[model samples]
Target: MDDSALLQFSRQILLPEFGIAGQTRLSDGCVVIVGLGGLGSAAAMYLAAAGVGKLILLDDDVVDLSNLQRQIAHDVNHIGILKVFSARDRLLALNPSCEVVAQPVRFVAHQADAWLAEADLVLDCCDNFATRFALNQVCCSAQIPLVSGAALGWSGQVCVFLYQSGQACYRCLFADHPESAATCSEHGIMSPLVGVIGSLQALEALKVLAQVGDTLHSRLLLFDGLHQTWRTVQVSADPACPVCSAADSP
Candidate 1:
């Protein structure tokens, strides 16, 4: 590591848990973020700021007036631009040293293998259950740690799936995607609520990357912004879970 780099992260290096070694590990790590909305916006920003070496961002949507309410990664001026491109510019502006790869295309299961294989860690910030399930399957197969988060209205949840340890994947939690559910756009979301969940998602991702604290593996953290309460629910691997079962086999 260069002397200037070390000096730049002097404050982080001072922490016993994240000394020079941990900082170096982070600097060399690669993280892939799917979706450039509320959750992705916050997670990507922090990861870049923390000196992650490489970031791969995926999002096919374009920024809109509504996105400015909570998608801090993009500003009003970026409206109509592809979300991935907007996020790339913002991250680069925050930390030019960090390499940002923008993929302004919708993520599909067929391409999950390549993306997950290349990432040291993956964050699922997508809006739909289909994408979330697809990402979970790919991450489980790749044995890559996946940090998943979701926000709807005033509630959100986050969890880390470490399939390498025979833990429950996202599919284990929700066997089938709910056919009827309200989205942030339909039901409306509290601007700050996304920030709370997104920030926590970023925290979980950092913890997983730095190996600093006990991760949320095998537990679901549910946050109720209106009630101002956080609840943890223990999750167990389903014996019949096709994805996790195959992951454990061989």
Candidate 2:
């Protein structure tokens, strides 16, 4: 790295766990973030600022007034812009050296493999069950690590699936699609709650990318903001998990 980059990431590089070697690993990592909402906003900013070399941001939605409450990346000034592009601008503004590729298209099963093939790590920052399930399958198939996070009302959760390590996939935990997943518009979320969870996603992503520190790896972290507590539990692989039972892992 050049003196300029060393100075740019001096604070993080100074850490014993992260020194120049970790920074080099981070500089060579490619991350895919599937949403630009509250969680993605925080994750994207931190990942870019942390020096993830390449970021692929995907979102088919546009910014709205309601999102400003927690979606920090998109400001009032960015209203009506496609989320991926808006987030790309914000991430670039934070770290111009980071390559932010904006994919303003909804990710579906058909595009999963092609899009996720080169990802070193994937962040499931999108809302909705279908997308989450699809990502789990694709990441598991590609043998990539996934950093997943969710926030609703006064609660949030974050987890990492080391698919390459035979860890549990998301479907192992959620076998059946829920009849309904609550939305922030209907349930109301604390602004900082998503930040907390999203920051954890960023932390886990960096840890995985740099191969430093411990990661969630088959563990689920539940955060109860109403009570200000966090608990982690083991997530065992389901022998009958249709998605991962006879998985195609790379």
Candidate 3:
């Protein structure tokens, strides 16, 4: 590492667990984040500041006045601009050395193979189940690590799934998508609630990148902001789960 690089992340490097080696690992890792909204905003910011070498941001939406309340990565000047473009700009401003690849299109099932194949880790900060399921399927097929999170109202949940570990995936926990899944827009959300969950998501991603510590894999973390409590539920692989079944079949 160069003098400037070491000086930039001196605090992180001072830690025994994350000494120069761990910092170097992070500088060589590539993480793909599939959203630029509430959760994505926080995750991307932290990953960039922590010196993740490469980041691929995928989002199809445009910045709006409403997003400013929770989406910290964007500003008033970014209104009407593609989220991926705006987020990449913000991330570069934080760490110019980090490489940012902006994909300004919706991630669909058909394109999953290509994206998941390229990423070292996948962070699912998306809101809808369709997108989540599609990404999960791709990760399972590619045998990649996935850090997933969701938030609505004052509640949030986060989990990690590694296909190679023979652990349960998001599908195994919630077999079917809810017919009436509430969104932050309709039901409203506490801004800081997203920050809490997003920070947890970043922590999980860092663990995956560093290949250290016990992660949320095989378990689900549920956070209730109103009650200020956290609960962990064991997750087991389901033989009937289509994604896991396919992963284990061959």
Candidate 4:
């Protein structure tokens, strides 16, 4: 940690729990962020600013005009460009020392394991249940920590799964996809809602990496932006969950 580096993270290092040690951990951490949309936009920026050593950005989509409403990392200039590249450029601008790897690809079942091979933590900011379920399964099997966040229609939710024995994996909460899943285009989403959830995801990821403070581990946090209220509930491991059941976890 040089003088400039210390000065750059001085505010964070000032926290008693964080200090120099936590800052060091953050400077050495590597996080994989799936999805460079609204959620990933916020999470990735904060993580990069906080000095996470490396970030792997994954997203197969291209930036569109409609995305400007919430996706903060990209601008009009980035329209039609791959989301991963757009976010990578922003993250690098935030912290030049941070190594940014941009992968213009979606998270799929087959690539999950390989993508996360070197990840110290993963931020699940992607939409859709299939990717979420696959990420949960791979993270659980590998015993890696996962921070998942979702935002849709003035509401959002976040959960942290440490993948420890008895902890709740994502599949433990949503075993199957709903018959009528809402679409962002149809239902609409608030610009700030995803920011809130994404920021929380970043916070939880930092805590997990720095080993400081109580994270959202084994807990689900729900935010109702319309009502301006927050709720939290304990999540337990599903004994029969095929993804994280005792029989399946190593």
Q: Give per-candidate clash totals.
A: 0, 0, 0, 0
Can you tell me which runs of candidate 1 are displaced by over 4 Å? none
The candidate that wins on lDDT is 4
> Model 3: residues >4 Å from true position, as ranges?
none
Report the lDDT tens digits of candidate 4 across residue range 1-250: 9999999999999999999999999988999999999999999999999999999999999999999999999999999999999898899999999999999888987877788888999999998887888888888878889999999999999999988778888999998877767879899998999899999999999999999999998889999999999999999989998877863545
lDDT of each: 0.88, 0.91, 0.90, 0.92
How well does each candidate superpose onto the true structure, as a TM-score?
0.96, 0.97, 0.97, 0.97
lDDT of 1: 0.88
Clashing pairs in 1: none
Candidate with more favorable, higher TM-score: 1 or 3: 3
Error of 4 at 238 (Å): 1.2
lDDT of 1 at 24: 84
Lowest-sum lDDT 10-residue window in model 1? 111-120
Comparing 1 and 4 on TM-score, the stronger one: 4
> For residues 1-250, could you state the per-residue lDDT of candidate 1 as single tens digits?
8897888778888999889887887888899999999989998998888888899999999999999999999998899999999999999998888999999888899977776666989989989988888898888878889999999888999999988656899999999788976788789988877778777877888778888978899999999988899999999999889889877877
Summarize candidate 3's per-residue lDDT along 50-100 as a digit string, tens digits: 999999999999999999889889999999999999999999999999999
Decide which is better by lDDT, 1 or 4: 4
After superposition, the stretches of candidate 4 with alpha carbons farther than 4 Å from their true spots are: 246-250
